[model samples]
Target chain A: MSDSTKVRYLEGHKGPTVEIPTPEGVPLRFTVASGGDRAGAFLLDAFLIIMAVIVCGIVITALMVIDSATASSLAFVLIFGFRNFYFSGLEILWRGRTVGKRMIGLQVIDRSGKPLRVEAIFARNLTREIEVFLPLTILLAGDELIPNLPPWGRLISLLWVMGFIFFPLFNKQRLRVGDLVAGTMVVQAPRRTLLPDLVEEPAEEVASGEMARFAFTREQLDSYGIYELQVLEKILREPKTPAETLLAVSERIAKKIGYTGEMYPSLEFLSEFYRAQRAYLEGRMLMGDKRADKSVAPQAGKPRALQTKLSGKERSRAKPSASAEPLQWRTPEDPPQAASQAGDPAGPRVPPVPVVPPAPPTPPADEV
Target chain B: MSEIALKSTQFRQEREKRWRELERLVTQVEKRGIRSLTADELHDLPVLYRGVISSLSVARSISLDRNVLEYLEGLAVRSYFVVYSPRRRPGEVVIEYLTHSFPQAVRDLKVWVALSMAVTVVGFLAAYGMTLSNLDNYDLFVSPDYSAGRNPSSTREELRAVLMNEGEKVESQSLGVFATFLFTHNAQIGLLCYALGAVPLLLVGLLLIQNGLILGAFAALHEQKGLSVELWSWLLPHGVTELLAVMLCGGAGFAVGMAAIFPGRRTRLESMVVAGRRAGVIAIGCVGMFFIAALIEGFFRQLVNDLTIRYSVALITGLFWIYYFGWVGRKARPA
Candidate 1:
């Protein structure tokens, strides 16, 4: 697939990642390093190399006063070695990282996810001599290399070199000629530590039984699935989320789920809802009944069979009891049958079954 | 709800120690080389890597905590590179390259090498015939700066003197500097030939042919003065190695160019990568050849004036190279 489409697809699901399947069938996802970071790393490495060459020149000049012959030969070999082998040698020894890459928190990795090899490293760095250093030298010594070169010739040469320099900008992966030829890519190497679980945080108000202030029926809870739960969890976890945004989101979710109870202090209501939804989803997951999203029809054999059996027995019993008593609060400890019985007294409860006969559309419940 | 809470939290509690240990070792290896780790730590590295990888898989499936999942992924990637990167020592790598990789690479490109040799020879013959027919064509083939003092207008004695180490003082100290300079200069030219191979075939061919034209024109200039024998002695000792080095580079360039143009069954990029890799090995070996040539040109040719010794040295070098590239590494499978 073209990179643009790939990026759009990834953005729809998650971030851009390089997925490498391991022998154990588990695919590992690594975030691709940004082009800006790669360019910064390259500039840093180039600066280091130039500084090294300059220091070597100064030392050799000092040695020239002692023995001109030895100093000249040493200068040639040292400068040549520094120019040619600095990146390759360090990468070989350090395992796919040079000094700049380490500092910038980037690394070269095989595109196919194989172990980086010596020949691959050599191929990549050798291309640098052509892709970067050669063009640079040509630009710097254009008159010396080609005597009496015209301005137009220089401009063409400049454009040619610039094409090579900006090559990575044209690709989604930000791969230069070296990376393409070597079948490698640079990636971010972030160091991270696990943070405390968001779920484990004490819900003191909910624990004190104030969660009963917002009661959701089985159908309302079933309206969303794990994907929506995760999105809600993200919003809840982000410290930067605005209070107004939380209130608006809670209002929208309340409307969708048909919850008419008071939701003053929307954060607490959302948090309590997050907990109940998570518990519901995890409970289903334990029974091998994973609900990927709201669109997925409930699983075929087990849950459907149970729901059909319950709907046959409870359909008559639920309608008669619905309008007979005032709405009752259901605690976290209440069973599903008990919670369903405590549904709103003003309207008939929606049966907790996959298949339901058509009924008159219920009006938007009055704000209680 | 209770089961999930217990499962995720307790699962982390059970494995967090090992994960942290692995992270510590990985961080150590990243800061220093693998040698910084103790032997026990070394044994544990791969085992812990596998553990973290498995943890990442499990966490991805069950954990809703994005921080935990992200942390495991980052840790797994870092440890993966450290554990799997090639660890062969420098000495072993050098020995392997010299004994197998270099010669095998050269042999693989033999067809292109022959083609490169033919192009240079055609240029040589054309230039030789032209210079012989008319001495005025020498200036066209050979540039003024490159000709130094020896040209068509120079007398026979002056041309002969250019061939011999006469009428010029040779400082022993400067020879070292001269050899170093020639080595770097020739190596750069070889690398340029290989680099240009990626651009177009015509460019590489032109460079090779231009080198041949200069040599052919100079040979004709000496031939007209009846100093062919002296010129041959002066040039052959170093020329055999130097010319072969240039041809190897040209051949490598040809391989790259052909890979780009034809590509056979593979895509153009894929073909170029394969060719570029093999060509890189040849390009590296050519630098050594240029070094040898530079030594001979700067020292041995200047020190040894006897015609017999120079011819013998040149013949021996030719035979050695023929045997080295053709037969030395053929008996062993490439590494």
Candidate 2:
């Protein structure tokens, strides 16, 4: 399992993630927010600021009819307040989420995974004046402000501004100068719902009289482990899985397990295999023998002894309804078991008397 | 086979109600803030949060369905922020900053403040000496637009009159407008100084020196006209507060610049984080100082014509700031 767990990261994975260890010692992984999302949120906030300034201007103009001097003075103060406080105020109030961030489902979190502090909020937002507004103002009013500047100077200024603007692109975590300075990162805050259990779905198939068509002896079931079971479970749960893919996976598993059964439809073979594999692995798990993957063998003595004891108990409990259950153990007369044991190159373990037979395969149509 | 499945199913069923309840409360708080919650819900929030956290831990250990794990993780993250985020009221925060954080930050950055002060003084002395040696040099240091007719060409009486406020009527309404403009302008410069501090130290130094040069050239123009005493009275009344505010901003900038440049043993980003936080407190405080200075510059200097009163006001302000930043919040440390 350790090897398989490590392989998960090395293989195909989605976007960058930040792992923040909780107080309970469990590390929680959050997806780093995309640059496009951050930019969209910033634009939304900028639009809101512009609208606010325009509204304030309209109000000031109306007040001018009453007292022009006071109204104009109020206008200056209001604009100044808005310019400085708009980002910091909202971020502080909302605890690292501005109105734009909330709308976009993004949040500014401390990079080191601490709780976002008020100082950090202020520091990050204040940098926007330099990183964004200062350069923008300079660009718009550059010729008027510094008339003697040569063409190269203007280009240099433009480059300087672009460096700040595209800073996030240069970093793996997509951190802007403000985020870097404040030790914060923006992350996606996705809302997800719990899915129905995959195990329960197989149980429903049994209720509909679609009993399993293919089954494996205990030795055949031990070829794979929990990690592969989970991978198979993921494929089975995905609605868009293609029939050819299922057939290929089923054929591959049948070859690996050395099954000499009549071929069944791919989905039926896979589901039956998944259910039995899960039950077998879980039963071993209950006996304190967890097989992460097929690379490691099950522990030698204690777990095997516990498993035999558990199977004995299960056989006694399942005797009355054994025929309908489809998971019943067969005697040594089972032809497939004899054939599998003889063909197996690796010497077989002590053959217990009770063994399961190949039950009829359930069709995949009932699942959909 | 069914026993293990039944156990997990039963475990979820028993706790699912609390988890749903927590989700509802957390959603409500996120949308409308914690204030929107009823007392009972507020009390239940922390309790439910703990329940969800524990459930998440248990689910992780048991290797529950992947979707269930993801859902629990997301819920826990959201609830953690809601529970742990700082909830100090705005009024409390303002009071705390004004009384403690602002002064502490200023004291902490005193070395950078001294360095900024030295640069400004050096610029002032250089400009003053050059302008005094040759009156024509005043124009080089002070722009004509900024001088507002009190240049090297103006007569001694004209320059003195400019400083004395002999017969000018103080218009309260216009003064209010002037104060607002001055406040906005000075606050912007202070913020710029703070912002530039994060980039390079040289820019902040240049800005501070430019301001000092302007002041020095004007002083030399008055000194050349033998109206030095009158100029001092006129300038110092508000200059003490206003210049200090500007210098504080410069100092804050220098602190940030130093953190970025040197960073000591810490990583540059980590160093900047500490400096940026402290500098923010100083930057905010400077705005308040600028406002007070603007009020004095707009109203008091123009209204009060007595040099005695002006000099006394300047002296009082200098002392007040000395006490405010030095001794105001030293004794009651958070420890």
Q: What TM value does model 1 have? A: 0.77
True contacts kept of each: 0.32, 0.38
RMSD of each: 12.7, 12.0
Runs off by more than 4 Å, candidate 1: A1-16, A201-368, B1-10, B28-43, B333-335
Maximum-DockQ candidate: 2
The alpha-carbon deviation from the true structure for residue A60 of candidate 2, after best TM-score superposition, in angstroms, is 2.9
lDDT of each: 0.74, 0.75
For model 1, how does the per-residue alpha-carbon lDDT over A100-192 read when each residue is reduced to its tens digit? 998888888887788877767766777677777766776788787778867787687688778877888788677777776667777787568
lDDT of 2 by residue, B189-243 (tens): 8888888888888999999999889888888888988888899999998899999
- Per-candidate TM-score against the hidden true structure: 0.77, 0.76
- The digit string of per-residue lDDT tens for model 1 on B191-294 reads 77887787668988999999889888988888998889999999999999998999998999899889888999998878877887788788888989999999
